[model samples]
Target: MISPLGQSFRVSKVFKRCPLEIQGFVFSADLIELSFRKFNLILGMAWLVEHQVGLDCVSKRVTLKVGDGEEVVMVGERRDYLSIVISTMVAEKLVQKGCDAYLAYVHDTSAVSSTAEGIRSVKDFSNAFPEELSGLPPDREVEANIDDDPNRAEFWLENTIRVFDELSCTPEECMKCVVSLLRDSTYQWWNTFVSVIPKERITWEFFQEEFRKKNINQRFINQKRKEFLELKQGRMIVTEYEREFVRFSKYAWECVSTEAIMCKRFKDGLNEDIRLFVGILELKEFIMLVERACKDEELAKQKRKAMIEARDTRKRPMSKSFQPQSKRSKETNLRMTISSEYSH
Candidate 1:
């Protein structure tokens, strides 16, 4: 047998047609014994072809067609495949050389969900897996091949950060995911940037700062800050205006450093009718101010609707038969009808 690095080893024995079951699908395969310790078993090309297997390297999953014509999928455990062990002497040398070390506890929970004791254990230690990390990541996008537009860069950075926050990912995990998602010029830039920096110091914050320095311009940020200062609710509804306000507030943090300043700034930008009612309350909380503004806007809308209804009622013409006519007016109408009939 030939190894991946082209080293040759003699096969000790071949076990033919050994039954193997994966995910409830049974198959027979030929197993060969070799002098290799890295893996317990490796499927050969002949077995893969015989089973009509399909492999997705990106997702690390395999699909196999069974005898009954049903396909079964098997997901790979990435950590198992990538794990490595080091001797105590090698570890000591690395420690002496000032190498950073991180320890991760990986629990095998494949059978935990089906067992009673495992269920109780999970309930007792529920904090181990946070609820936020259970679901899929957020749907926000960071373009793989982004341009030099500062707005797009800022959006990408913010969106990446938001996704990391939602997933409760650590700095190391964030860096790994971000590096994987980068492509084209951005990927090249990352490669060059990381070449000189030590791996231990290349944190998420450091990456963000370097990325902003390369992609975002100070002039664009200043412009956005100015826009935030000049922002007004205008024709936007309370909810929409509030969304924009929050989106721009980050650009001008100093202006809204305090809760009172934020509330006051938001109130001052509201429409006149809503501002009149909301401003008088002098609410300190930003959330309360927003709620009050929404309520006042609703009230104003109802008042306008009521006025419109009343005006329409007044302007509506009375029925012709219900109108009171003078005798002279009735006589003139009767004469005109009689004259029209005689002419016809």
Candidate 2:
């Protein structure tokens, strides 16, 4: 279909003149099987149709109806895929604009029943539309080559890599350290992202409208639930795994951000020693802290257990002493019963 953005066919234009290909002015029939492989690029067209026609679900047809009751019906299978694609495209834009894409997608569900059919949340759309946004330029393009100062850069990097190789740390620990460094570098990029969001410009209603066009939140919830089940199957609680997952997720975000910001500066002329020193310092510090904390917690738990055992040992002797008191009470009761019988 033509969108106002000129990305696709305009309904008015198409409707006005029935092409020979469409056969007898039946645009409603020809819309089927017309797929935009990169649907995100034509998001403007999808939005225009979603707003004007609205979605109507009948027993026989899943229809996208424009003004004047022009409708496009499709096979049930195609309807699902098309709806998911359209919804995801709309959701991604709302998310890019810093709106609450998930909530917006929820409202879109009622407006277009099939919009949220295959999708559940903004995150879902993110997964579905990963290639939609080209995002920022590559880090390498932004910075000069590290090898521009070949000898100095190589020598410094060699030492850093050698030291890392000589260390007895496991691969997991090393990865964590590297990730921490990446995150530290990208903090500025995150701030930049926040700064760009026009808080005042994006209203809740606008977000809701966009969200309804694509069900993002439901997809997110469903994905999380699936993850929880997998964790449970592995004898772990979803909540516990989620904590670790969140930590790594933050680290991943930071890594991308840091690389984008520092690569240019590092390439420009920064000394290798300074870069290596800064990168390694925070990771080393974090490892030391984590190790110390783990040791202390273990020591505290052992000490608590020993104390509990000692208290139980002392109580055992006291319990034995109470055994004699019970025996004496039993004897005294027998004597009192005998005396009462004699008096009677």
Candidate 3:
């Protein structure tokens, strides 16, 4: 019988028709709310089973007791197997959630530690839990902590198994007791959720290379390597233009060094060649050329502006004036265009 507060059940049975043998059953109950979108009316069951004997003697069976005292048979493993049953409705829901739900139980026949060490023992599994859940109460507490963190259920269940192991219950025994808490239907739903949930970025290849290096300064080296890889991915490397700029900058420094060499050689000159070099135009000549070019450009600009103004003025074209010679230079007339109405 199931307790009102929800507890696990233990049972043992022997069939008279089969070869004489003993078997144990561990059962628990759990409830799951439906999304109400599909309204699937299917029913199902799941079983978790484990066997530790050399010949593999563990087994789990599930049968649905339907209305009118009838029984519905489901397909699954027979002997030395762990299995879970899921209705069509539940399977669809799990498919939607992106996970598979299964019920499995471990069996232990080890006389050394009994079922406590085999199933519910904390040492049997690794706890890959975050730091947030470390300080919470045990899963078996009368009430869950106020945090109500989404991952609490899994943490609580795993922690409870560890506690059970300390209390002398085997892992197999604890699994049997908690098997029903996980339904095949809900398992599928959880799987789907996990698949679609956003995950933090993780690139293992770079990390692995750093992790394998053998050195006393591995941590610092790995950190630097990680930063470099990130920078590469972010495209912080130099471009063609930047590379050219750096090359030219180095050449400019070389020019300064050459100038220093020239000055020293000039001071040591003892021949006509050195005297001739001193007379040649140097840095000051370059500056004079630049100033001349600038003055020429400014003068050209002023001449162009004056011509434009003269052409645009409201005045007649200038007539050619002839100088009369002493005896009968004929008076000459020149054609001129006149526009007295010009705006300027």
Candidate 4:
């Protein structure tokens, strides 16, 4: 006998005229012994034709016409069973027999639901999972080369750590998620790293230290620290300067250790004009110092605008109608005197 998947199976034995009872109605059918596991018995077309049986798949009903000319309708029962896993061999056999086969992917939701209700639930799963982590990470071209820009590597590490902290991920979970995010050369590098280091000795901290040592070298860090120390506002606006100050401040942590020191360092970088106004306030808080500096810049702009307006007013020519009467009369008399002298 050919199975659904086109596999040949030998029928062991066949029984002719085996009486089968359906809804208290007796019918004769030929039963065959087969190795198929999906069904206990399958009725052949010849049996259905001889019995004048009609099947309504939509309604799940069967109509049987007996030899006594009596018609009986049998209603099908609905049964819900958990999915079964079958081997490839069995699947092929079923497909060969012309059975409609469908493949379904199932996920265990109970475990996820239970984890969500637990106290340590946040540490168990990533915020990206089940949705954002549904498929493999997309293959995108690397825009910035990690070798040239060590800061990019540091930024990615810092951002990943921040996300892990927000999700309350444990060290082990962090290790797993961090590896998944790595791609291309980075992933290959990780594989090489793990091969050298014993898995038992590797912790999240150890991984981080090694990663920083390899990607972000001591020379790069020293350069960044120097840049931070020499950073000045110069032509940059207060907001732009503040952004750069915050960005580079991490490398030189000793310089701006406290709020007072941070504020002072930031204030020292401002332009001379703005410093003259903000320095007098001596604000200790960093945020307040920035706000005061911005306010002072705006006030300075307004003052400069007012002064320019005043200067322009003094330089502007006055109309004859608006001029003082004494000044106008002196001019008119001078013109008449000049005209009379010319005539003489």
Candidate ranking under lDDT, highest first, comes to 1, 4, 2, 3
- What does candidate 2's lDDT look like per residue over 1-344, in tens digits? 54322334324222222222221233322133333465522223554465343444543344454447665554344435577756766765554454642223335545745533454555444556677756533322333333243333334444544555554333444444433332322334333543766856444344323323333344444554454333221232323333443333322343325543323222222233233333443333333423433444456558789999999999999988877556888899999999999999
| Candidate 1 lDDT by residue in tens digits, 1-344 | 66554335577688998889787767888888876566678898988998899999888889998776889998887635534533544664564455756558787878545643333433455567778455444343444456467887888888999898755466777888899878789999999989999988899899899998888878888888998999999999999999999999998999899999999999999999999999788998998999899999999999999999998777666555477889999999999999999999
Give lDDT: candidate 3, residue 209. 29
Question: Using Cα atoms with residue i matched to residue i, what is each candidate's TM-score against the true structure?
Answer: 0.53, 0.20, 0.13, 0.52
Q: Whole-model Cα lDDT per candidate?
A: 0.82, 0.42, 0.37, 0.81
Alpha-carbon runs more than 4 Å astray in model 2:
1-247, 251-284, 324-344
Preferred candidate (lDDT higher): 2 or 3: 2
Error of 1 at 1 (Å): 58
Q: Give Cα distance to truth, residue 1, candidate 3, Å.
A: 39
Instruction: Write model 3 residue lDDT over 51-162, tens digit each, in one string.
Output: 2212223333345443466543334465422223325445645543546445476877675664422445333233655443545333333444312332354345446656
Total backbone collisions for each predicted model: 0, 22, 26, 13
Off by over 4 Å in 3: 1-150, 183-344
> What lDDT would candidate 2 get against the real structure?
0.42
- lDDT of candidate 4 at residue 299, scale 0 to 100: 94
